[model samples]
Target: MFKTQPYPHQQMAFDLFKDKSYFALFTDMGTGKTKMLLDIAAYKYNKKEIDCMVILAPKQVVPNWTFIEIEKHLGIPHTVAQFRNPMKVKEKEQIFNLYLSKKDIGLRILTMNIDAARCKDGFKCLSNFLAKFRCFLVIDESTSIKNPSASVTKNLLKLSRKAWTKAISTGYPAPQSCLDYYSQMEFLREGLSGFKSFFFYKCFYAITKKIRVKQQTREDEDKPKGFGREVTIVTGFKNQDKLTDLLDSFALRIKKEECLELPEKIDIPQIIELTTEQKKVYVEVAKRCMSELAEDQEITVTSAITKIMKLHQVACGHVKLDNGDWIDLPNNRLETLKNIVEELPDEKIIIWAHYKKDIENIHKMLGESSVTFYGDTVDTQASLAAFHNDPKIRYIIINPKSGMSGLTLVESSLNIYYSYSYNLEHWLQSRDRTHRIGQKNNVRYILFYCKGTVEEKILSALREKKQLSDEILNNITNYVKEGMKV
Candidate 1:
């Protein structure tokens, strides 16, 4: 009773863990983890195992479950309720009550942002629903609850107790380190890692070192005294073989390269020469940052990042001054983008920018021929639909922060990075928006950076970080294989 045919990997994942009480799907982005979850839900519902399924996802990804994936994949009748507006308490309560009171035979589905589940009222509504109906609880992009001390993680752990089945899904589960798996696994099932507490789990897996830091204190005139304090920090991770074995027992990990015969990803770097005025501003910003560093005895990472961010902004053709006003500098980045668009006149292109100014400027430059999917867009779904369905819409200007996760932009095989963030997740997820399943052509990622600026440095750093992350992932995969042999 499936609407769309499932990929072999998706079917394999569902078949393996559909009946399990708890599992993790460590599938890569664009590998259709959402559809697999729905298939499992449908299988269990038809068997009278679960009366309802509740999906908790990011604020941006919540709607896709109700509007796209479920409608496209689930063949059985289902009543869907999505909690989009967390502020509408009365409306949400009425909808919840209506669903709870219904004597219908169809499967019940509710999707809500993970952020909402952390709140008092939102949690109350969900708790009430769970209390009334049998639920298969799933957390999409489960990394949101990676921090064990977070209130939302604690609340979700409590809520997980009520579910008949539980699952957590993410392309990159351990984005930073293996330590991220602690709270996420705990949410799936407490003591799943064999360790009773996070502290013990950390001690077992992490190699930590003690370091002394000078603690700042206000003594004489609001700031002066600095006393030394010792702190323990994670130097590296150990016992990966054991950790991989533990996770492999209950998790299915799939990478796009291994399962899909999809098109190759081509990286094209387009360097833009900054205008005279832009170069002047960039140099001035760099000098100021250096001066600030010289003046400050101890510069925090936050302040240092802020200083470097100014240099990035300058390279992007605009800089925010100390007075909270933006000064537009001269740059050829937009002109270069326009020329690239001209060259790809017949093809659809996705333009990604980190700054709001860049998005606005590109939108203005492209005009009606392009649609924007970002924070200021009134209807992101409509924008996405137009880009997907309309032939006239050849360009889609997007902010990676807003349009990065859970989006399928297969209509565009060409992705141009007008500006990018330092976030590796943003870069990876945004690139996959087009490169994922159903994309026919070889996906080309073109990055535009000003020559000899912080933009170049940022891109370099992202590549190095990605390489490190890939190495770690490969090591884990090898360890998992070795453990399987035993």
Candidate 2:
């Protein structure tokens, strides 16, 4: 028995099929698909059935596997290769060292980003790495290669032939059209759809309209080609039920809503210390805060409020420019949050941000897995429903001021605050979103605050249920009177 036990659905998925040469796990995000696949790999390596396993995922997600998943789940000696770039000489030597030091090792796992597949060096390095042993290949977020004409898709399709066993996994495999599944199915089995190429597969099932269209000759220009009657547009799909059945045959699909009986809410206070650059910036900002208190006696109340907001934003990692743009600063809050997210078990997470830019930055990092809802979210109800009902949506980032009340999001066992403001009502209401009825698990609240900064002052005021306007005035007055800088 393994130290980390599998969920019931995971166990059933593993038990249901172990003999397939190529497989697919079309499971939702936060449902532990990576662990299930790694468990299978560990079993094969232990039984001497396979000697090497190669995993590919999005670039940002590669570190989660390399530093957290592989190290914590399987404890396997693996190398995560950097593919997109001018590869460093040291990185090349590091990879070669791992390749050569395969003594008494159960299995050698080489992980890389999927986008790396397009580069010539990425193609050659992965091609050579796969040729050394009896390799098992797994492509995480397999939908990345859904485009039939994409260079990465073609590269992965060629590499798929080199492995004895291969697998691909994605939450929404056919996102826009059933046509999206063609390339993924082709990777699984050469003729799984009983068609050789995407053209034949689409022709067999799509309702197409042949129409001529103008071709682009250059930037900001369009002109009809000499021959313009060769184009075909898919008007609609045909035989979707049959397509679903075809996919159902090889893909092990599971919905988190149908499977997980999660635990109670747990609160975590994630304190991020200032980086070296942040520390320098903090001193400057602190001096400005004091200067605002001492020299800006005649400024309007609105200006005072704006200055306070700017100071808070600086503490949270970015400073808003006067030109309606933002300058990113060196703040440890984002990095701390990313590391904490990777260390935890995959579960639906809710991150609350007081600043809108904080919400945007976090969502950009997680891509589609995380959604943002604030003043900008036009369809709040639809966004709420998707976060509640859909398992693939792993995060709901809320500006608590906008989404604090009138919503119940008990699906999340963890709630993180990338940054907080001194609105006591907003904080109380946001905290209740995940602690309401029907929530069986303890909610975890992870708050990021920079030490020795104005952020702690706001947090203190919030804790005491005091208003920020009053607290800021009083704190500034006392600090100046006491001749203190911080």
Candidate 3:
């Protein structure tokens, strides 16, 4: 067998793009798109068609490309370097030196953080590397460059001409409107969208309206001389069919269900390791969680579940300290989630958490590519609209109860429960949100649970369709002994 064999659909994708110099992979996430790209890069490299390959991805996923994906999928040996902004001066010098050295490297491969391209140093490093070799530049999650005026997009567009071949990949091609396609497609090739500039492109697709809102800032209120800025809102789109037809020329559209045989639902459990401090706190919580089982202690559904909820909170890395203060213990939950995200294929994903803090942390950890749907999410409707329409939004962090009633997230094929809810209805409703109508592929649900913690019990109860309060009544006293075995 090959080092990493491609599925039949993946092999077909590889063959279609292998010979093309500039083509877009519109394949949905989790369909082995990355491997297909790597396979094609390997094939062309062996034919001496390219001297180097540059893979640009988000900063959070840089380690994944350098360590995991490259090794598993590509059979060839490559000297990989990172062109990111956060690296120390010394580190950049070392990587730059290696890129220039005359080593017996089959291909001078580099996986750079796309956000770094905004800086002058990051842009120059990759541009200089591109100048030295006949390189193929591949942009994964290409919607990152949808904004025409973003610094990174400008820097990348300037360097796009240096590459011998260019490709952009994304499951969502037009997340907001057809107007977003101009900037992304412009990177694939000059005039690929048959437009000279973004303004011209926007004019062709969007009905634009610039409205100036009244302002009362300190200066404006005091002097009454300054005017508010005029912001242009896309009133609506025009001639979408024309734009879609244009995209069909270079877009390779692939949906997961059309190509792969998959079950209706796949459930996977993510094991989380607690930090030393977390373990210490967890032990304390566990002791109190079942104290009701003692000879003199009284147990009730209300009291037992409340204690269990606190234990669940501790497992999520935060807890309420006495004296009405909140104490956040050292926890690895967020770190574990980041690791899981790195392993997933580049695709839109839904993340459900029971706590608001978990939702916020998850939103922050994933950076600008994520949106949270909860009570305090400002302008909840607008945020939900973006979650529904924005291609750049790859992760949606949702509070099950808040998102359960009437929302559809079928754009994503994977759903992850960062933590569980005791409410059976919320849990089941969240699971169905991504698997309903408009969903073309099977949905995979990955639930993260801390073994030997309250989460395990909740997950067990939900899985067995047992009331958590009843489940606790049966084993609350023997939780330490009968339950919580790793």
Candidate 4:
């Protein structure tokens, strides 16, 4: 019942979990987890086990499942509907009602962004559908619900209880900590982690300590009346063996290296010399951040992140002013990117940038030779098709957050990071877009950063966190302060 032949690893994963009621695919990016999920759905549909399938994924990824994945992998005749907007309640209900009225024996597939589940209308619509049909629910890139406190996570957990079967899929399941596994597991099946609440789960698996610090008082508050507050911080993890045993029971964990003989992933750091204007702007932002840090005895994480993001933005050639306007600073980074593009005229390249302005600038520089995949791109699937099929379209400019997960771009072996965020999950998932199965040539990753700027500091932190698997943003204040020294 499969349209495409599965890889050996994919076939094994399918055989193992096809009949399971609840499971997780901790498969590496570019390893065809999507195909495995579709194969399972097809098997169940053929057996008359499920009347429909509901896939909840990131906004950009939701479209691809309907347009590309199911069309490529599933052999069954199915009716597919994509819920793009959460505000269109009436339209969504009509689609669901149409599906309910249909008496066809074919599988019915509904795809929607996980964020929609948080909205009242979207949640009610999906709830009603689940109430009527026996659904095989899947959450792709399951990390979106890793936060237990998020409204979307809570709503999904509740909705998951309605499905006949469920699965969660992601390349990097626990990006920051073992704590990330808590809510994702709970979404698959409540108390899957052996703990009912995140608070107790954290206490069981995380080694934490409490420290007292002077609390920040409001400007109008009396300073003498302020008291210290004790905060609990995770020092490390515990019970790893038990957690591994639990996950191994229901999760198929596979890495690219273990299952596939993929090409080498070579990382190259391309250091650029900042222009006079760029250097001046970067230094000003760094110094201002240092001064602010010096003045604030207790800086909130949000304030620290904003200050660091300002410095990183300046390093990336633009700065957002107090009025929310972005002014470009003269920088050699774009010129360097052009030079690299010219040097590889015939090669298909993927250029990743953090900002929309960067994607726009790169798109303009490449002109007709480039297609863009970002949040603002009107037709992401069309852009993806052009990149995959057209030889003349040699460049794909993308924002990592939007184009990072659930994509296979083996057409390009070279990926240039014009800019990137501090999120390690984005870095890892984006890198695998070209390096996954079917890649013949060695994958080359080029990272661009300005010397003696926040860009360099950000790269350093990313490297360290990539190795350590720690949260990079937790140390943003230190990165900003060190950038000023540089």
Candidate 5:
């Protein structure tokens, strides 16, 4: 039987961006954002419509789109380049050569980190190119634009007027406060022009308080206090069901859970065959983690496993030492994770890690085949697109702090916890990447932990707190509603 694909919700995202002037596809992460973007690009290119498109993204993931995500999903062939190393005169010349005459090339894809975009030459060149071409500009994970003063943000808006189309894609655009929404919505041209600045938007949905604080009653000072006004917390995007209809006019968006029917849990283990010397250190670390960390600590299987995972990190080569510095050890966790991914039987998988060091090391090990979105990859939309693209990615190593909450990674059922983090919020959001309602498979989380450590203790505490968190959230929602009645 032919499988029915792209559940209704996903199809809607695809249709929403077909012809809109400016809009955003705020689908959750793990949703099929990458696939939808590919389809949109292909549909436009095939019609001989647009000559070129530029996807701006964070540095870490710019490589993912050029090397992996685009090739894997789009039917159209496109030339892609990384916009880093622009300071090198030779590299700049090469990039210029690729950008020459889009009429000859179907789509000239350029990716630059947000930092480089802040430079004078980078901003000028990008602005000039967009002004010359009939282009579609997409900013993925658009929250990076929330800071109105950022040069990249200013440059993007300057270029936006020249583009025939513009779109923003984000999973959680407003993670912190309503104030975050102003700059994002302003870039999308979704907010009122009269409210031209972030301050104006903040004033629209915020209350101010003047306060003076005293230490030992020695001094008093006056300062402005900001409080959130009644705002809609869109756990999902607004009018989600109608999203596709809206996008068909300008762009397309898809959720992974709603599209690809894959496995629920992917169990991958990086077998770290320790060198004889490293093994000795690993055993010692494991012994200490178990006895000292878990002895007085109330532990569960999950917590015990988590501690071992941290101790394993010490063995693998990288560990956050007590003094806040990360030390390199004789460990192979990074390589092991890659090996486990390499051996996977050709299925989609989601790999989660806790630290930036791990993310970069894992990226090095996995090569350009995978997409990474964490703090390192923040402030760009292209990285967001790479994550959403339908690609044969071996791993998606992310910091729970950055990759968690706002995204949906439900495209692959096999979730591998290569390492654990300390934040309960990040843990919950990361797990939901696979365990959300769109999933049809029995989801399983395979965690790799050392035999013992504080990491394990943290994981245990988070697990217990998770249940309590749900209750607290529910209570908060009710409280907010009741207060609104007054």
Candidate 6:
């Protein structure tokens, strides 16, 4: 028997997954959810309890699982397979056969982006496989299943029925509403059982609409048909400790603050002040946008603002210029990032960007000394190999969507989010890439945002959403109504 030493939190998580058929690991960002999950898979495989495991995540992250997590965390030797988009029936048949031969393999891990699971055939096949072999289905960044209306979310509910055990992992579960808990809890089969009866369960925490009033024109009246009543889950840090003891039977969660003996972090935004020339151009562009708006023409002010930010971003030297393309700017984030990493000891650092452009810039700045994983790549095996084998490679610039979950980059405890995206789920998962398992040192995560711009506003809104601040949401509503063009 290949025995593996478990981190305190990993052991706790493994224990929880042992008995619970449906559960959640609401561990914070930088917690070791990925390693905990693999440990659980190993245990189940050893016990012959499950022949396979399916990890469903965002598209940006699916590749990382195949290339990184399975290799890094599953201490015991295990053969893993990947499911690529089947362009032909022949490929589908091959995947089908691989899925059917699950029992023979000690632990078969199939990773797919949540989008793949939403397709009718994909859902049906997954459902069939689960029914045939008792499996463990772990949803990394489980909030993707938060919405009931989304096709993927619906498919997850349907596909999850086949799993002998179901687990959801997320850092910030309700980044929007306590109602976010409803679908997640439902996924766990906690109280509500399933989605069809969710409305009935909702009645327990929501109030019904009783009246409606029209605007002064008496033409349109917007009235709430149902409003949520305050419903709080009494689980806190204390209960979490108790829950851990119980989870020892099946699941584990590790917080970076509690377990990792990492370094003190200094997270500072290296603001790239716009050059005078760029500022002049930006102001002119903004003026043009406003002029277009005045003429009742559709203008993506959001995109326009993004352009201004890009211009400032260029001033920082992060932008690239190609032949016959628009003026190529440079990425300042890379320079600041290089300085930050140079300050650290010889250990490697993980750099996350929301765009491929940033990845290109980071690549150009770092040169052959660095490696990256993004959308436009073949030979996935080669990319992973380069990263794993090269000891001197100091930085790995990754697209957050592509590198966040199911990847183990724990060699370095320092992670920097160069830019942010509105997708709370991706941001949460990206931080954990370096914070999860094998990290003996404490980890520091830095989020860089340009102050006073729409970027900052979005970040503020997201943070407030996590707190479920109705006042903040109301203010945002007013701000959007006033400034947003329909």
Scored by Cα lDDT, where does model 4 land? Answer: 0.84
The per-model lDDT (C-alpha) reads 0.81, 0.72, 0.76, 0.84, 0.59, 0.60
Model 3 Cα lDDT, one tens digit per residue, 132-179: 888999888787798999988988988998899888886665544577
Q: What is the lDDT, from 0 to 100, of the residue 184 in candidate 1?
A: 89
lDDT per residue (tens digit) for residues 52-130 in model 5 = 7777765554565667677767666676666775457776765776677434655776667656667887787678768
Q: lDDT by residue for model 1 over 295-403, one digit each (tens)?
A: 4444443454566567778788998977988878888888899888998789989999999999999999999999998889998888888988999998999998788
- Could you give candidate 4's per-residue lDDT for residues 384-484 as a string of tens digits? 88998999999999998888887888878999999978677787788888988789999999999877766676687776656222333466566776676
Q: Count clashing residue pairs per candidate.
A: 0, 9, 1, 0, 53, 30
Candidates 2 and 6 compared by TM-score, better number: 6
- The TM-score between candidate 4 and the true structure equals 0.91
Cα TM-score per model? 0.89, 0.55, 0.58, 0.91, 0.56, 0.68
Worst 10 residues of 2 by lDDT: 220-229
Cα misplacement distance, residue 342 of candidate 2 (Å): 27
lDDT of 6 at 291: 53
**lDDT (0-100) at residue 429 of candidate 5?**
58
Scored against the true structure, residue 26 in model 2 reaches a CA lDDT of: 84
Off by over 4 Å in 5: 1-10, 46-49, 87-94, 190-194, 211-398, 401-442, 446-486
| C-alpha-based local distance difference test score of model 1 | 0.81
Candidates by TM-score, descending order = 4, 1, 6, 3, 5, 2
* Root-mean-square deviation per candidate: 7.3, 17.3, 16.8, 2.9, 11.6, 7.9
Query: How many backbone clashes are present in model 3?
Result: 1
Worst 10 residues of 6 by lDDT: 229-238
* Higher-scoring candidate on lDDT, 1 or 3: 1
- Where does candidate 1 stray beyond 4 Å? 86-94, 210-232, 295-301, 464-486
Off by over 4 Å in 2: 75-84, 88-90, 212-230, 262-486
Better of 2 and 5 by lDDT: 2
